[model samples]
Target: MKMVIVDKANEGKKLFRYIRTLAPSMKNGEIFMSIRKGKIKINNRIEDQGYILKNGDVVKIFFPDEIIKKYTDNDRNKYRSIDSNIDVIFEDKDIIVVNKPAGILVHPDRREFKKNLVESVKAYLYKKNEFKPGDYFTPSPCHRLDTNTSGLIIFAKTHFALQKISTLFRERNGDKLYLALVFGKISSSILISSSIDASENKENKVAVKEAHIHNFIPEKSKFIEENPTLSATYVRPLKYDSRLSLVEINLWTGKKHQIRASLAAALHPLIGERKYYTSQSLSLSQMLNVSNYYLHCYKLKINGYEEFKAPIPKKFSQILSEMFKIDAAKL
Candidate 1:
C-alpha cells in the first residue's frame, strides 16, 4: 500500500531517518538515496528532495509495488500439484527419496507454483498408495536445491525422519554431494567464502560480489548481522575436458546457494550460472537446456550410508560421455 505519513509525527527528523520508521525494511542509506533519487514525494509535490519533515507535514513514501512484487498470483499457484512423474528413488519406513528434475519447485511459493514437487508427490502417493484423503502426509524436503536444479531429494515420510534429518543438518551429521560441470579448471582444493547480495535488475534479481559481505560503491561493507555461517567443501575433480570439468563437491554447510555462490566467487562459476561473473569464466547459459539447474545432488549420505544416486542427468550425461568419453551408461 502507498504510505501517507502524519505531520509532526516524526518531530522534524531528517527525511531518510523519518522514513525509516515508516518503512523499516529499507536501510537508512537506501532511504536517503531514494529521497535524493526523487523517489520520495511530499503531499503530491516534489518538494526540495532534501526537505525534512516538521510537525503537521505530510510525507508521501513511494514504495513502488514493482519492487515489492517479486511473484505474481497467477504464477504463484502454478505448481501446486505435484506431477506424477517424480522418480521415486528410495524409501524406508521413515523417509522417501525422489529424483527431482531441475525446474520443478520443492514447494509452492504461493498457492500458484506451476510445478510444485511436494504437492505432486502428495497427489501421487495418495492416488497410488491408497493414502486416505487428508491423511497426514507431512511434506517436507530434508534439503533443497535451486528450483532449476535437479537430482536426488529426500522427503520425510514420517515426522521422526523429519526431526532427525533436520537435527542432523543442524548438528552437521548429514551432508549432500553435488555433481556439477563448470567452465574452468580448478586443480587444487580451495575454500570459497562470499557475502552474497540480492541486487535487482529490471527483470530479475542478480547476485553480485564475492566478498565476505557485499558492499556497493560508497557503502562500507557492513558486518553481516546474521550469524557467520560455517562452511567446508571437499572437491574431487573427476575429469577435465579443456573447457569444462566434471566434479563432485561435498558441502559442509546447508547455506542457500552455497556451492553456486562460493564457486562463482572463486572464478570457477558453474557452467550454466548466469549470475556472479568473475570475468574469467565461460557462459554455459547457451549450452544449458535441462529443466533444472546444471547442478545435481548426485549423492547423499545420512549418518554415513550412501545408497541413493540417480545416474547423471541426461544433458550432462551425453556431455560426460562425449567430453570425458566415459560411457556413463557403464558407470
Candidate 2:
C-alpha cells in the first residue's frame, strides 16, 4: 500500500498522468487495470483514470511489492554531475533562464544519457533551496535548443508558469533570433517559407524534405499532415567575405532543423554543421580545433513578459577573428 498527497505542482492534472510520473515503470495497461480493479483510490473513493487531481486530495495505491521496487530504484547516480558554474541569465519567481554552453544537450536521450542541461538546472535550483523533492511540480525547460546550439533556455519554476510559457511557445508568440556563419557570400536578405517533412531514417538521422505543398507523409509519424505546419526563416547578411558570410537568422516558426535545412537547401549551409552540409573545403574541426557547430541563439523575447540575450561563444569569435579580422565583442 502506498499513500500520496496531491501538491500545488500537480493540482488540476489528470490522475493517470500523475501516477505515471510517480511510478514510471508501470505500463499504461497496468495503470488502467489498477483503476478498473479498484486498486487505486482518491480521497478513499474509487476514481477513474481521467479524474482531475486537486491539492489536499489523498491518493492510495495497492500494488505488489516487487512492482513498486522496480520503479523506485533509479540509476541517477550512474550519471556524471554537471559543473556548478552554470550561467543563469535571468530569474524571477515564475521562471529561470540559463545561458547554455555548446556541446551540452538540453535534455537526456537514449544515445546520450549522462550530463544534460535539465539536470544541471535542477541541481542549481536544489542548491538554492528552490526545489524540493516532495513538491507536486518539478521545474522544467519550456523550450529546447539543439545540442551544439548555444543559447538561452528557460526553465519554469512553477506549474502555472510552465503551462503559460509552454502555451506561448506553442502559439508562436515569442521571437527567437540566431546568428550563424555559412559558406559562400550572401549579398541580399531572403525569406524561406516552406512546409517541412521530417522523419528518422535507417541511419537514425532526421531527414528533412521541403515542399511548397504538403506531401511526403511517413506512415509511423505524419510530420506535415497532422500538424499542417509551415516553417519560416528570415536571413540577413551581417558580414561577408569571398568564402564565408556571417548572417543573422530570425526564426519565425520553430521546427526540427528548420534553419539548418532551409539554409542548406539555399546552397549555403552553416559552417560547422555536419549533418546538414559537410564542407569538404574547410574542415571546421581542423581550423578551429573544436567539434561544435557555429549556430547561436543570441536573443529571445516573449511578448509583454521578458527578453533574454546570450553572448556569442569564444570559438565563434575565434573564427570571426581568423577569417574576417573582426572582433566579436564589437558586434
Candidate 3:
C-alpha cells in the first residue's frame, strides 16, 4: 500500500480525479472496479470515488509500485524553472492581490506566450511548498484585467476563497475606481450611459449607442437597439488644463470596453488608446510617446472587506507631469 497526504493544492479535489492524476495508466473501468473492491480508502475508511478531499487527509492506495511508476510522470519537475515576477499588494491565507504591470497577460491568450500572471503566481506558491504537482485543483484568479491595462487583481489561494470572491464579483458588490488620462478639460462630473453591442465582431470590438431620454414621455430612458447590453460610467475630472485632463471613473456597469468606448463617445478618448482613439487623442499620443491607453484600476473595495489600492505606475506619473504640469504625487 502507498499513502499520500492531501495538501493545499489537492484540498477540494474529487477522489476519482486525484487518483487518475496519481496513476495515469489506470483504465476507467479498473479505477471504478478498484474503488468498489475497497482498493482505495481515505483516512482508513472506504469512500466513494466522488469524495471531496480536504487538506491533510490520508489516502491509501493498494496498488503495486510498478503500476504507479510506469504511468505517472514528473509533473512537478516541469514547473521547477518557473519564477514569479509579480508585485504583491496584499496576501493572506486565502487570497493574494497583485499589481500586474502593463503588457503582461493575466492569463495566456495564445500558445506563443508561455509566461503569464497565473503561471507566475503558481510558481510563487510552489516555491513555498504550499502547492504540489499532479493535483486536480490549481490556484486560480478571481478576476481579470486587460493585457495593456495595468492594475490590481486578486487570486484565490483555495477553492473556498475562489467561490466566495467570484460570487462577489458577479454580484457587483464591490467598488472599483479607475484612473485615466484623456484629452480635453472638463468642469463637472458626467454620467455616460450607453448600449454596447459586442456580438458583431466576436468581442474584438464593440459598438456603442447612446441611451436616449424622451421628453414626450415621463423621465424614462431606453436603449434603441435590441438585446444590446447597457453600460454606465461616472466620470469626474481630477486635474486638467485646456489640452489634457486626468480623470477618475466609477464604473457603474462592467462591460467589455465600457470605459474606453463610453469615453470615446463623449469625445474624450484615453491617451494612447488604440481601439478607441480619436484623431486629436492619437495626435497627442504621438507627441507624448504614449503607446497604450492610460487606464489603471487604482482602487477596489469589496462591500464587507477592507479597501485595497494600487499606486499609479511610474510611466503614468511621468505623463501627468509633462502633459498637465501637475504633480501626480499630490493627486
Best by lDDT: 3
TM-score of the candidate numbered 2?
A: 0.78
Q: What's model 1's overall lDDT?
A: 0.62
lDDT winner between candidates 1 and 3: 3
RMSD values for the candidates in order, in angstroms, are 14.4, 6.3, 6.5
Expressed as tens digits, the lDDT of each residue in 1-331 for candidate 1 is 3565544324445665555434434556777777777677776666654576666666665656765332222222333333567788887666778888887888867666376787676656555663322222334688777787888888876545666787887666776778887767765544444545546567454353543422121111222123254333456677785666777887765666677777776666777666544444544545445223378887777884566777777876886776678776554
Report model 1's TM-score to 2 decimal places: 0.63
lDDT of 2 by residue, 19-112 (tens): 7756654679998999888899999898999999999899988877766665544412221244446889889999988989888888866584
Q: If both were scored by lDDT, which would come out higher, candidate 2 or candidate 3?
A: 3
Question: Total backbone clashes of model 3?
Answer: 0
What residue runs in model 2 are displaced by over 4 Å at the alpha carbon?
1-17, 20-40, 43-58, 61-83, 204-228, 278-291
Q: Put the candidates in TM-score order, highest first.
A: 2, 3, 1
Off by over 4 Å in 3: 1-74, 200-203, 211-229
- TM-score (C-alpha, index-matched) for candidate 3: 0.74
